[model samples]
Target: MKSTLKDPEPLLETQWPADPVKPRKAGWGGLKRRLAPYGFVSPTVILMFVLMLVPIVMVIGYSFMNNVIMTKHPKFVGLDNYVTILTDSVFHTALANTLAFTFASVAAHIVLGLLFAMLLNSPLLGTRFKALFRAVYVLPWLFTVAIIAVLWRLLLDPNGVINFLLMNAGIIDSKIEWLSSPGTALFAVTFINIWAGYPFYMVSILAGLQGIPKDLYEAATVDGANNFQRFLHVTLPQLKPIIISMAMLDLIWTSQQFALIWMTTGGGPINVTEMLSTYTYKLAFSQYQFSLASAAAVVILLLSMILAFFYIRHQKARD
Candidate 1:
C-alpha cells in the first residue's frame, strides 16, 4: 500500500512570481506602422478634395442652374443651360475652331518635335553642343504662355517685324493681317501654340531616343536599312510609346489652351479663333452666364476625354 500510494504536492509551496517583463501593448509605433501609407497619402488626398473635387462638383452643380454673376442665388433650370449651349451657333463655331486648333497644333508638335529629337540624338554632334542645343530648344517652354502670346502678337502685327522682314525679303509686297482676318487668325494662333508647345515633345521624344539601345540600330544596319528606312521602321517603332503619350498630352493641352489665345487674339474677328476655354471664360465672366460657362466647361472636358480615349486606343492597336 505504501509503494502504491502517491503523495499530493502542496499547491502554495511552489508559488511563482508574475512575469517581470510586462506584455508590450500595441503603442504609437505599432499603430503608426499600420497607418504609415495612409499618413503619407493624406496630404495629396486632402489637396485633391479641396482643389479638384470641390471645384468639379461645384461646376457640375452650377451647370444645372440658371446661375449668373448678378444673382446672389442660383435658380435650378434642369439642363436648360446645357440645351442652350448645345444649340448655340457660337458654341458650334468654338467647337470647330477648337478641334482644328488641337489637331493642327498637336500634329505640328509631334512632327517637329520628333524631327528635332532625332537631330539632337545624332552622334555627329558633341555632347556639350547637344546639351546647348537642347537648352536652346527648351527655352520656348520656359516662357510663360502670356509672354509667348504677347511676343508673337507683336511679331504677327500688321506693321510688325515679320511683315517688315517679309517685305524686305520680297516674300510679300504688302503686310498681311495675320491676327485680324478670320481666315488667318485661327492658324496664326495655332502656329504660335505649335512653336511654344513643340519643345515638350522634343524633350520627351529625346529621352525616348536616348533610351533606345545602340544594339537595335546596329541590328537594323546589319539588315541593310538605310537612314530613311531606319527612321521609318526602327526609330518610329521604338518611339511608339513615347509618341502616343506625348500626342495625347499635346491634344489635351492644345484643346484647353486659354491664356495664349486670349492674350493673342481675344477670340476676335467674329469668334473665329474661339476655343471652348475662351468661350467658357467669356460666358462666365464677360456675359456673366455662370451656368452656361459651366456647361461649356463640362462639354470640353467630356470631348477631350473621349477623343483622347479613341486616339490612344487607335495608336495602341496600330502598334
Candidate 2:
C-alpha cells in the first residue's frame, strides 16, 4: 500500500491502429499474375486451330486444282477454272440469282424480324405467351426441307389452295403457274425462306432486347424521347451485333436452300432459280461431269470464302 504512492502519470495509453490502405506493394509474383488469364484461353485457341485451321487449309488446297472421282490425283489448273467460271454466262446467271436471293431474303428477314421482335418485345407482353406464339412461328424451321418442299408444292399447285382461292375470288380466270415461271419461281422460294428464317432472328433479337439496360429507356423517355426515337437511338445500336451476325447466318442458310428450290422449281423452265448447290449437284450427279463438278465446287468454295471474308471484314470495320 505504501509503495503504491508513485506518480499517477506513469501509465501510458499507447494506441496501435491498423495500417492504412495505400498502393499495393508489388514483386515478382505480380508479374506472373498478368499471365493468369492465358491459362483459361489456351484451350479455346488450340481447339480453334485444330477445327478451323485444318479444314480451311484443305479447302484452299482443293480450290487450286482439279480432280475427278476416277482420278487419284488432282491436277493443277492454274486458275483456269476461275477465269472460265467467272466468264461463264450460265455461271454468271447462277451467281446473280444467288446474290439476289441472298440479299432479298436477308433483307426481308431483317425487316420482318425487327417488326415481329418489336411486337413481341413490347412491354407487358407475357413470356409464356410470347414463347407459345414463337413455337408456332418456328415450326417451319423444324420441318424437313424436302418435306416442306413437297408440302408447298401441293399448296402452290395450279389447283392447290392458293390458286384455288385466287381463282374463286376472280383474281384470275386462269390458274397462274406459281412455280413454273422464272420470275415468280424465285420470289416463291424466297418467300418460303423468309417465313422459315425470320423467326430465328425474331427470337434471338428478342433476347437481345431483354439484355438491354431498361434504365436507359427510362432515362430516354424522361428526356422526352418518343417510342420511334427511343427505338432508333437505343434499340438498333444495341442489337447491331445480333443483326450483323444474323445477316451472315442468313447468307449461309440462304446459300444452302437446295430442296426448296429444287422441288419447287427444279432450277425451272430456264435455270432461273438454280443456286450453286443445285448447279453442282446437277453437274456431278445428273450430268456426270465429275471433274467439271469438282471445278465448279472449287469456284463455289472461293465465292463462299469471299462472301465470308467480306462479312468478317465488315464486322471488324464496324468494331
Q: Highest TM-score among the candidates is held by which one? A: 1
lDDT of 1 at 290: 85
* TM-score of candidate 2 versus the correct structure, residues matched by position: 0.75
Name the regions of candidate 1 deviating beyond 4 angstroms.
Answer: 1-29, 126-132, 307-319
On lDDT, the candidate that comes out on top is 1
Instruction: State each candidate's clash count.
Output: 0, 0
Task: Give per-residue lDDT, candidate 1, residue 161.
Answer: 94
Looking at model 2, residue 17 earns an lDDT score of 100
List the candidates' TM-scores in order.
0.86, 0.75
Q: After superposition, how far is residue 242 of candidate 1 from its true place, in Å?
A: 0.4
For model 1, residues 93-165, the per-residue Cα lDDT tens digits are 9989989999999899999999899889999999999999999999999999888988998999999999999
lDDT score of residue 2 within candidate 1: 58
Root mean square deviation (Cα) for candidate 2: 7.1
Per-residue lDDT tens digits for candidate 2, residues 172-289, read 8988777887658888888877876787888888889989999999999999999999999999999998899889868877876677788778877698888888887887789765
